[model samples]
Target: MMKEEVLSVLVSNHFGVLTRVTNLFGRRGFNIKALSVGETENPAFSRITIITEGDEQTLNQIQKQLSKLEDVKKAVIIPDDLLISRELLLIKVSADAENRPQLDALISEYSAKIASQQSDCLTLELTAAPEVLNLFIEKMRSYGIMEMCRTGSAALALGTQTVYHDAK
Candidate 1:
């Protein structure tokens, strides 16, 4: 059975680390569904949230390989059994006076927030599971979608603990 995994990696904020990490996945032939990388609050570090789809054994191997990289401080595979995952999507829909109200109602049904509005378009921001976001995108197609952006899944382990592990 195909499964999806979210990996949160903490690495030194250095050039080429992203490429190296991505190359590792590429070498393994795992398709990355979504990837988000940003500097952490700490100036010296960055966090990478990667979503990939593969079988369980392949996912495990990818995690192990990522953890072994020199720049990688820690790599944790968020298990399906113990994490809450979500992605943020910004969708700009083409709208006109005639269909504006209808689009507004559809956005409300999805509980999307209006991030911006212009005479020709309305940008809606939604935070939900990937499936929900995909559903919204599909529905908006009929209304004419101008553009969209999605933040790859960011997940946290459920409970009071964090995923960081220090290596001496």
Candidate 2:
């Protein structure tokens, strides 16, 4: 069975690092489902969160390959139980006087923020788990979606567990 895995990588914050990492995945024929990268607490390093689907052996190989990269300091698969993740979504939906009330109620139910509104459309912002965002997207479809953008998932390990470089 295919399993979704999240790999957190700690790497030097330098130019071309992201390209090299992504290229590695492409060369191995692995499809990245989602990817998010940002500077870590220490400015010299960055954290990369990658979501992919594959069998156990494939996941292990991907982790090993990521660790072999020059800029990568640490790479580890964060177990789902120990992972805390969220994604940001911005959706624009058609809205007029007739359906505005119902749309407002739906937005309130999802805790989505009103980013903007116009006579013809309303833009809403939501930050939540991937599954929640997916459901919200489906709900908006009925209201006639104009456009939407979703960011890749960003995650952290629960409690004290963390992926970090050990240069000692």
Candidate 3:
């Protein structure tokens, strides 16, 4: 059975580190559904959160491969129930006097912000769970989406868990 898994990877913050880390997944024939990477509190380290779908054994293999990389400090799977994840969605939807009021209702319903507005369209900014963002996109389709850009999932374990507990 295929299952979605989120992996938190701690690595050295330097050029080409992301490429090398992602290459491990490519070599194992695993597709990354979502990936977010950024420097950690410590400037020399980075945290990479990856979302992928695979059966148990394959996922385990990918984790092991990630740990073996020169730049990888640690790689661990984060359980869904214990994870807190969010993504940013920026969408430009068609709007005019006829539909502006309806679009305003949707924006209020979802707590989305009007990032910008033009005579013909409204650009909205929403940061929410991936599923919520997906639903919002579906809702906007009827209104006509001019363009959209969404970031990959950025996540961390809830409560006391820390991905970089031992980083120096």
TM-score of each: 0.90, 0.96, 0.95
**Local error of candidate 3 at residue 152 (angstroms):** 0.5
Which candidate model has the greater TM-score, 1 or 3? Answer: 3
Candidate 3, residues 1-168, lDDT tens digits: the string is: 899988989999999999998888887798799999988898989989899999999899988889888899988898988988899999999999999988999999999999999999999999999989999999999999999998888888899868767633
Model 1, CA-based lDDT? 0.87
- Candidate 1 — which pairs collide? none
lDDT of 2: 0.91
Q: After superposition, how far is residue 148 of candidate 1 from its true place, in Å?
A: 1.4
- Model 3 segments more than 4 A misplaced: 166-168
Better of 1 and 2 by TM-score: 2
Residue range 63-145, candidate 2, lDDT tens digits: 88988999999988889899888999999999999999999898999999999988999999999989899999999999999
Q: How far off is residue 74 in model 1, in Å?
A: 1.5
Inter-residue clash pairs, candidate 2: none
Candidate 2 structure, TM-score to reference: 0.96
Q: Evaluate residue 83 in candidate 3 and report its C-alpha lDDT on the 0 to 100 scale.
A: 84
